[model samples]
Target chain A: MDFRKKLAIEPGSTVSLADINPEQDGGIESKEEGKEKLSGILDEITPLQEMLYAEKKHALLIVLQGIDAAGKDGVCWHVIRAMNPQGTYVASFKQPTEVEKAHDFLWRVHQRVPAMGQVAVFNRSHYEDVLVARVHNLVSKQVWSKRYHEINNFEEFLTENGVTIVKFFLYISKDEQLERFEKRLEDKDRQWKISASDYAERDRWDEYIEAYEAMLSHCSTAHAPWYVIPANRKWFRNLAAADIIHRAMLDMQIESPRPTVDIDEIYRRYHHAVREA
Target chain B: MDFRKKLAIEPGSTVSLADINPEQDGGIESKEEGKEKLSGILDEITPLQEMLYAEKKHALLIVLQGIDAAGKDGVCWHVIRAMNPQGTYVASFKQPTEVEKAHDFLWRVHQRVPAMGQVAVFNRSHYEDVLVARVHNLVSKQVWSKRYHEINNFEEFLTENGVTIVKFFLYISKDEQLERFEKRLEDKDRQWKISASDYAERDRWDEYIEAYEAMLSHCSTAHAPWYVIPANRKWFRNLAAADIIHRAMLDMQIESPRPTVDIDEIYRRYHHAVREA
Candidate 1:
């Protein structure tokens, strides 16, 4: 079975955190072997991204959702850095400013969607409205509950245009998260990244998990699929993210545009220039 | 009476092109006097636009729709040119590409909406779907008929999110259209601008008026007002457009954002530096 198919949360299927394992790694054990496998996939990704850029007919949107410190930044750095800068852009949604709060939550997300033949990476996407907003009571229960249908319609609308969507929920165990935070605390350079607020958020672990389980079940549509990646092992996380993205790019059927003029006629003109050279 | 109210399309009122005189200049005559009045409006507009840009709270969308050579481009060049370039942008909607045709008509318009604290000018907007689409039988009557309600809802959505929308239908008499096309034929520099299709479109003038009348009646709302501007004379056209825009900006109550830092401390530090010098 395809790794993406294995990981993908089927549209309309009920989801539970217990069904997914944070420590699983596609049955791979050797860290060196995972690294070697990922390097090969990275090479193929560069050319496929170049073709997608040249064709300018389709767009790809990759959404990342997870609790704090679940390695969203790591996937962006290791997996998407191979593509040319002009072809891909990362739009990180942080705490909304007053101006953003004035509009609908989707207003900011809609603004950041990719144009033709571009790849847009959303580090944290509009899913926050359903997940974090629901858990924290940022909006009413009625508002958050209605968002599942709204998000489905929104993604369906984007796909009807030239956009293709892939979503990832990087799953990390609670104990592993505590271990990472402890490591950050010991390192002087990394202490600033780990704040008191993170542990405060970690206190309500079960509520967050419940929110994530609902988002996976409701937002995973036929057009926009969600893949749950095992994120306890950093090496496995990087490899799985790279493998699924490479496959999606291959499926795009992207090709260089055909010449508007006759190829032979262009060759004749080129031949004159080539002879001079 | 407020100039905006004088020109604004009254919400829920029925419209007829016969009720409007294309040559009426708001009872203003003497080109020199009109130019002077517009200059005063221009002076008020520049600073108001700067305040809007600085506040970063509101967005303004100006929609212009008319037949070919009804001065859509001219209004853009004359009235909009006074605003600072950093805060204003113009998007001209032409024939939809294959991807655009796949989505709802407002999809392209939604993509081009102004960011907070900026002004967006649509040369022709989603109204084309209701106007040109209706006249050309591009879709079934059922489809085009539904668009008025769709457009109303779209504009309402924008207004609910702090956007102020003002629409203009540039009215021109059929005899004046013939005169302009003749003028285009005579001038060598403008000869390329005249096209066979323009005449073909002009031949169905009454049909277009009917479409515009329907749009004015059905789509106009309190928040997104439509104004019919008499545009047969170029000077009057520029003055009316500028006057309405200036009034709308004034109504926005756009003010410069208050300083976040301590002004007194900064002033004290500046005084110390002056004393040391």
Candidate 2:
């Protein structure tokens, strides 16, 4: 299936993680085949990103989110490795600093959005106001519920100001997660990835799913859409993501900017003086 | 002379524009020699900036201020051309947008300070509060005068968070500015840069000088010292600015971060999986 057609959450449609298979391989027959397709997609993305940077007229924001071990980092690393580091920016949201906490929730996120002709990837973004903030009773239900509309309006404002937003929810099943956790235990280099809270959070998986379902339903607008990528197979997850991002760039109709200066006139005027200098 | 030592405004000392000659060209004997030294400085800056971005621990903010055609843009353009575009950020302060005017004067400037492991250049910075606001009587004397201390404290807070601040006041005489404006009128490519307001602002040169002198004297502190650069000659301005910027980066003592993951162990665990994929 074309992942863009299959994966985009239609506006007002309810989404359930249980109905979506985490094991789907995006129609690629094998891991090797998927990797090859992903590499091809990467080659396509690099030049489009260069055009986006050179044009200096539009901004692209990619928001990555997932539960623990859901491949957010893996997808960001694999996919963005294709683009020039000069034009690609990554802002990983951690626990809010005291200064950030003093401002409104979107304050930090808004400040870090891609400037004109730039691409900024948010490791976790304003959606966390709905996810972790909602899940932990950090605020009242009414407050979290109101944030969906606020986020939609804020994103609309950004789009009006030339930012294009793409969001991804990496969907991994509990069984697959346990298998990855087991691997983490056995691999010395990966042990740092394990935390007691990872298991604690895993136990609350159903609650998170309900929260994600509401988020996917409420905030998935035409201007900024969310893609639900199957994450049990890491290679397939990266491939499908690469395909969606490439399609979004194609949708943007990106063209490089025309030269600002009249080069011939400049040469005509300054040619003799330049040689003396 | 070391540009850092020569240019820094000694705190608590009264400043007089008459005491300094804007036409003075550091100690460089010739423009060609200055340009060669600038190229060498740029070569030194590129690697240091790379180490800074990799280190992800410190931030540098360079603030430029001057009258019209004092070469704020020139200094920023020439100095920053040496650094990696990925790691260098430029925030040019134009007339305040409505939203910016709604908040405290420093609100927009504080938002644009450098983040960790980044170099942020402010083409015109918060110093405008002292200069333009004071010159035009935009704010009450009580309000604008009190902001100098507030700004000093705000900058200190940034320093405590691992930021190094450098401020430059590009000092050029009224005669030099008029000559430059005349040149702008002659050059078709530069005509867009000239405005009726440029001439109007030129009439207030002495008021601007007094304002700048006060700003240099009152706000120049040991931590984030101000440099009053004699900027009549473009070549000398670029070289002296580059020298001071290099000195600031050197003081940062930036070093690349150590590897986070154990390479040998990652090799041991992931080698087989990598081969299969």
In terms of lDDT, the poorest run of 10 residues in model 1 chain B is: B268-277
Model 1: residue A255 alpha-carbon error in angstroms: 34
**Quality of candidate 1's docking, in CAPRI categories?**
incorrect
DockQ of each: 0.01, 0.05
- lDDT digits (tens) for residues A1-277 of candidate 1: 2679889998899999987899997987699999999999988987777667767799999999888879997787678766654366667787899999999989999998988878888989999999889989999999999999999999999999989898999999998887776565444334446545676688889999999999999889889999999899999999998889988888888776543333333324422322122
- RMSD, every candidate, angstroms: 16.3, 9.3
Q: Across residues B1-277, which tens digit of lDDT does each residue of candidate 1 receive?
A: 2457777788999998898888977777688988899888888898788778777789999999988889897787678866755466667798999999999899999998987888888889999998889999999999999999889998999999989998999988988887786665544444445555676798789999999999999988998989999999989989999999988888898866654433334324422322111
What overall lDDT goes with each candidate model?
0.82, 0.83
Q: Candidate 1, clashing residue pairs?
A: none
Q: Name the top lDDT candidate.
A: 2
Identify the runs in model 1 with alpha carbons over 4 angstroms from their true place: A1-277, B269-271, B274-277
Candidate 2's residue-wise lDDT over A1-277, tens digit each?
5788899999889887789999999677899999999999999998898778777788889989888889887776678756665466677787789999898899999889998888888888999999989998989999999999999999999999999898999999988887787676555445555556676688889999999999999999999998899899999999999999898899888875553444344334433233122
Write down the DockQ of candidate 1.
0.01
Clashing residue pairs in all predictions, respectively, total: 0, 0
Quality of candidate 2's docking, in CAPRI categories? incorrect
